[model samples]
Target: MSDSPAGQAAQKNAPHTITLLQHNALKGFLLAAAGLFLFACMDSTTKYLTTHYNVPFVVAMRYIVHFLLMVMILAPRHSAQLVYTQRTGLVVARAVVLTIASLCMGMALHRMPLAETTAINFLAPTLVALLAGSMLGEKIGGWGWAAIVTGFIGVLLIARPGGGLDAVGIMFALGAAAANATYQLLSRLLASTEKAIALLFYTALLGSIIFGIALPWFWENEAPSELEVILLLSMGVSGGLGHYLFTLAYRHAPASMLAPTTYLQLLWAGLLGWIIFDTIPDSMSLIGMAIVAASGLIIAFKSH
Candidate 1:
């Protein structure tokens, strides 16, 4: 009745292996949660920096740090095939659009309340739905169209053209939304064949190059304080890590399951806004945020 050596080993190690796997899964979920929180911190810091510094200078510095960080992260995972890919065109297009989105969001952050800026940016999902329908010929049903229209109305409420709108902020947020929509569409097109790391690597590389050319013109007369520089560096790290964890979460779970989790970002945004700047979004802004969130959540549920 004695067991063979191999059978004994298997029995002895199986429980430990299962425990290790469970630990790893839990670790991944915790990392994703931390990433989301850091991303909110990054947004809050960007808003703070823009209040004291020039938007272009702050933005360019942010990208430069982010680009360098991405390269360092990718060098270890090096693949020569990164430069040559079937989705090269789409990658480049996505990078250009992302660059525009970043710049516009920078402007919005500088000119508007943190929560308001974040709320306006929510329009991107709705825009993505419409863009997919028009550009990719995806079939969007009646509810999708309704959601899209409601999202736009939310945008209008925030913009409130005649009512103390910061013209630059409003325009920047709109431009960011459009670019974000384009980026999402391009991501869907490339997801099947391109490695996620490769796509992210090129996007950061190309974005750095595009922003590099313009950095000189916006260079500041005085360097940022050491503490400020540290925060700026953290911003890049936070953003890059957030995207990485988000990609990982998508692999582990379905989009529908993860979609609701993203709404946590708004709560983080609001908390950070209050803690750092003592700025609370007004009643109108909160109403707009509710509308945008409702529309996006409705679309997510409907799509499911």
Candidate 2:
């Protein structure tokens, strides 16, 4: 039987309940921002290390140490289950493309200014959004197309004649963006069927294996000193910890609440570049970066 009218009135006035897994949007936003900051740290550290070490080896250290850290900590907790995935091929493809993106980004950072390089990469999300219309049959409207054009213009300004940027570095940065877009696309494709831990495991595992195979060619006979070793290890820690923080964040908030703040990494990149390397973007370059960021923001909001 239905409850009395008084009980129904009381029930209607009851407070809305939040699940243990989700509801804290403020905490989630902060965590997402922190995760993006770690990503900026990882990029800056890579650029600094590449000044003294080989690009391939430096990139390898990141993935190798990251893979090791994951094994040491995560494996004990999750055991073999950590490596299980329903979609093997898509997962590997995502990992491979991410590895490629890392390699390309490392090479670019070794040559280009951190802020500009990161700005160029900002185009990747825009590319993914625009391409989804063609690839995934998602109709991106006129605004999406406008964002696409504006994003390229921003890149062109950053790479324009006498921008004082290296042509090869600019190309490498573009390549990284392309590879990164592909990686994101594959990640989206696999999100439904794959477990997060398994996806993370394969990415780190394959990145280490692929880069480790080429390590010999770039190996230095003179071992890095103890301090240098610490820096190398820090790269991996920042990466692993960054992802961990991101995971914690999602448990408290929705993805839509967190997506826009990813652009904060570009700002963090600029500040760190100035402080760490004494590099600053020129006026035109700064404008370009702004345009790129604006374009990405538009795409993000529209999708929401």
TM-scores vs. true structure, each candidate: 0.80, 0.84
Q: What local lDDT score does residue 184 receive in model 1, on the 0 to 100 scale? A: 60
Candidate 1 at residue 27, lDDT?
45
- Tens-place lDDT per residue, model 2, 2-66, is 13475334434642222124357788768768988998999999999999998999999999999
Which 10-residue span in candidate 1 carries the lowest summed lDDT?
15-24
| lDDT for position 17 in model 2 | 21
lDDT of 1 at 272: 89
TM-score, candidate 1, is: 0.80
Q: Give each model's whole-structure lDDT.
A: 0.68, 0.77
Task: Give one clash count per candidate, in the order shown.
Answer: 0, 0
Give per-residue CA lDDT, model 1, range 47-107, as digits (tens): 9888778777777777778778866766656654345445578778887888888889889
Worst 10 residues of 2 by lDDT: 14-23
